[model samples]
Target: MTGSGARSVYIASAEGDTGKSTVALGVLELLAATGGRVGVFRPISRSEAGERDYILDLLLQFCSVDIPYEECIGVTYDEVHADPDAAIGEIVARYHAVAEHCDNVLVVGSDYTDVASPSELSYNARIAANLSSPIILVVKALDRDPAEVKAVADVLMADIKSSHASTVGIVANRCRPHRRTDVLDALRDTGVQAWALPEEPLLTAPTMAELREALDATLYSGDETLLDREALDVMVGGMTAEHILERLGESMVVIAPADRSDVLLALVNANSAAGFPQLAGIILNGGLRPHPMIDGLVRGLRPTLPILNCEHGTFETARIASHTRGRMATGSVRKIDAALTLMEQNVSQAELVGQLDLHAPEVMTPQMFEYQLLAQAKSDVQHIVLPEGGDDRILRATDRLLRRGVAKLTLLGNPDSVRRRASELGIDLADVDVIDPTESELIDEFADAYTELRKHKGMTRDRAVQVVRDESYFGTMMLHTGRVDGMVSGAVHTTAQTIRPAFEIIKTVPGVSTVSSVFFMCLADKVLAYGDCAVVPDPTAEELADIAISSAKTAEVFGIEPRVALLSYSTGGSGSGKDVEKVQQATELVRERADDLRVEGPIQYDAAVEPSVAATKMPDSDVAGRATVLIFPDLNTGNNTYKAVQRSAGAIAIGPVLQGLNKPMNDLSRGALVSDIVNTVAITAIQAQNLKNGK
Candidate 1:
């Protein structure tokens, strides 16, 4: 959890037979194969003869270390048992041990009965929160019903949201080998990250070899070649005979023709009843098909099942039935292929955590911001500052944001002026607090604090107090003294005026040496983050390193993992210069300092994004060609590149979302749109929640 580019991943499930451990093992193996130092954690287990140990043993065989099974999962018992509150604490502690030994730890879920027992459905969520790791859900595709799977997924998502845990995605294991498309389609409907991992053919057909080898050459009337293969979802049609009826239980047999009238009558009777088998239907062949009696039966039973007919003899139908088994047998190779495809689309653990934060209960809907024209929604600490205090648009927006729960309203102007402007514009500010800057209750308080903070700069309290009289200073002071959680005011003012106060009063958070900004480059289905565009003119290696970390954190806030690529003219070893060296050094510094972050750089845009290009230039580098967070060495590069990507590539660029501040503080471009304001507000509120959560 605390090593270089190595973060802990927690896999869990809300239901039984979800295949949590198996999927977790496969993910650990996949990441480890990519040169990641991985560790496994099974938070709780109930085993009789240490079967869990065997599973963990298999995991260690693929990992870089040989940790004990106990180390793999923090807690284990002989039988199924779990204590809700204690399980989370114990699991986190256990994962901490494993995480200490490796760069990342993968926590696997136990049985659903165990995960859901003791309390209800809080087990897996609690574990993810306790460990602060992203969660991967394992879904089993045994029943071949997408709706069933979706129901399970819905419960899992709700639980994850409720527990405030970071859930990365989901893997559907033990899928029918050839039904990947169907299962994948089903998973997509859930609106959650899901993959159908293949079940091995050999595993599915454990008895195939033995069955083929043991079969007597003359046991059946059908050709042996006809029985060579089988389908998984097969149907067997048998002519209703006394011998077949006795042995019908051996297969999914549908008896027919023995009594067209009786069978039709029975079918009609069963058709009207509920909970009957969804049969492949009955076949009446040989020209002795259903008569009027059968016709009546067929018509009546049509609602329940379908019926098919042919001119072929009973022998042909029997032959086809025998061959159905081969077609119906599920294979494992297809499952493996699907797993690989899923692995290709797999999002990193960090991305999932960020999504959870975005969807937290405290967040406000974008519509709320749009209706009111407020840029952000804040919960618990709602009071905000409006720099353009007398504007009617600000008042209306304030009311909207307030009603929609964006934040508490604080207008920075005279009550009379704001009210008169609202009346002129038919806007209502009845519930909004109009803080006339000249008569503000906190103006004197801010003046004193301002003087104290700037006292050493040769400025007297009078000058400092005079400077503090500005609206920006009042807003900045409110943020500093906890009167407000954040401030969004740059529309009617220059960037300098909006940011200067924050730089002077709010200051950067500790351990973050610089304040930087990034742009959220959004597309229809994806987003890429560009950083160092607003601050740090010509950052040094150390400063660039800080930019990468800060950018990744910012990307996380917007529901993306920061796979940072420190951009330069060349990738890998193509070009050489101090600028390039700075980028390379900055990348290394980021890796060294933030072991938990994933970043690679000193690479060109192509190499950082194109898998083939990256593979050719940096075959062994993990971040190359898969970078999500692009770190620019200087403000010029960051700004120009992001603008190009936005305009030429048709990417919808959002932000200039300021990062590394003590609280949420954003700068709006003069040309920012209403939609942009709404989104900025969402991002800010999400950031506020993250800061509140201390991440």
Candidate 2:
């Protein structure tokens, strides 16, 4: 694992269904990208007669490995059972054969078909030693806590050590996502390289093809492509058709007796109707097929699901389908992508691959960036308040944030209403602190503080009481009084309503004269910071300079190294309009104040971002063509540019991240998606971290 010319690593697991194949595929992807002719090998095949092993097939299909299924396997499960000693030698010999054909080889080890048999770990360790490959241990952590994960990994490492097989790394696969950080910390205490990939439901949820095979069912009707969609839930169609309508949801597979034509009609009509969830499929249970007449009529409906018929009773069919577990097999494009991305984002990859002599800075994919952002936020958990809890987007985001251990949250809304809405969405927000501003004991105290702060504006206690009842004002008071770390609102309110409280209560930090914002423009290959898009309609030269300085610092806070560009319709003095002069003046002020910063002004957007365009426009400037932070001259230009890029390039604009705040409080677009709310909350948490450190 830590030597030059390192060629192989054995991906071994102590348990079956541990998702070790997914881990192997992820490592194979890293090795293949190292510019080598990579090959794959499986020591013991679980495959049946005249078929390839599913995991080996997956590695060959999705990765750059070119070896055939038949050539990759050394022995069958039966062959291993006959002579365990002989199987180890054969595995080594087979690995050599595959290794001879390529520059590197990845060997997948045994699946502990029976966890009770203590010999699987021993067998894998001996085989790994014989093959002279470093072992990367894969452990089951699906429902295990940090302590249990650590205890299990330590025991495995000791056993592998006893067998004299060198251990390189460990992966806690299918870990509880909320405890992701704890899992890594726990594994690292045992002193091997470690990482945890969070559990994704879709990866384990059985698809229709799996259900069909489980029930031994035949497709009676519908599109073939629908068979790959993962089942979200299973509903037995025993209830009346009207009751079935009550439980209808996305990706459901309804089971019913073949004679229940009413159930079939209800599902079919729901599919055609405007207000129903898109069904995954239906399973017609009980040894009877749908009547020929009923089947023909259902076929006339649009967007048909995969209607399957099986020869089992409804109870027996449901049992079979429920027990079906999905594998990382062929024809699942989405699961493949998700597995690779999840592994890629959550590993100590450089250490795992460094021994193979691969070295390059990875471009931060959006998935990677978001992962890092959440990790940063969770490093020091912050308390963030959501004033727009009535918005479903906010509540959903709150659920995700809590589940990921990203923040402690308080929602500003009526407790009953929030609880009722959360129940409808099937999300548990029971533990989240709810503050009904109107009914809070702190209302009187908060109103008193508000009146005292705004007395010069003719504010009285009675007037302050009314203002504090508004969620925004109350939430800001919570942050200002050190009751919460930050606040994210405006999903249902306007920007003015969300931040006006912040402007009055929390105010600006030291060295910042003007309040501004930056939208993290996540492009395909890189992320750029676009500034003052959602604030500051117009500014004088001095104010624009303050905006640039603040934006550059904000970019740095979020891991973007700032090379500032003051944008205009000009490029480095090529134009002579007043607008160009304004940008030029702001540029000078930025340089004079922040001499350590790399900044350029009167730069056109194309020249600021496009290297080819910069070559002819401003080739001599260090900030041109590679700017990470773009400072706009005015609101009209900045707002319009960010939106156009967001729509045209499909870039994710993850802000209006407010800068220059004493404490972190942010606004959201009214049309924000749940993902946007989650990201914004994370940003606020990170900002609170910086504030806590007095940065």
Residue 585 miss distance in model 2 (angstroms): 2.5
Please give the distance, in angstroms, between residue 229's alpha carbon in candidate 1 and its true position after superposition: 72
> What is the TM-score of each predicted model, taking all chains together?
0.47, 0.63
Best-performing candidate as measured by lDDT? 2
Measured with C-alpha atoms, the lDDT of residue 623 in candidate 1 is 89
The superposed Cα distance between candidate 1 and the true structure at residue 327, in angstroms, equals: 58
lDDT of 2 by residue, 360-410 (tens): 234443544565677789789999999988887787687667666789999
lDDT of each: 0.61, 0.82
Lowest lDDT 10-residue stretch of candidate 2: 356-365
lDDT by residue for model 1 (529-581), tens: 88888767898888888778888988776557679899999887788988888
For model 2, what is the alpha-carbon lDDT of residue 338? 66
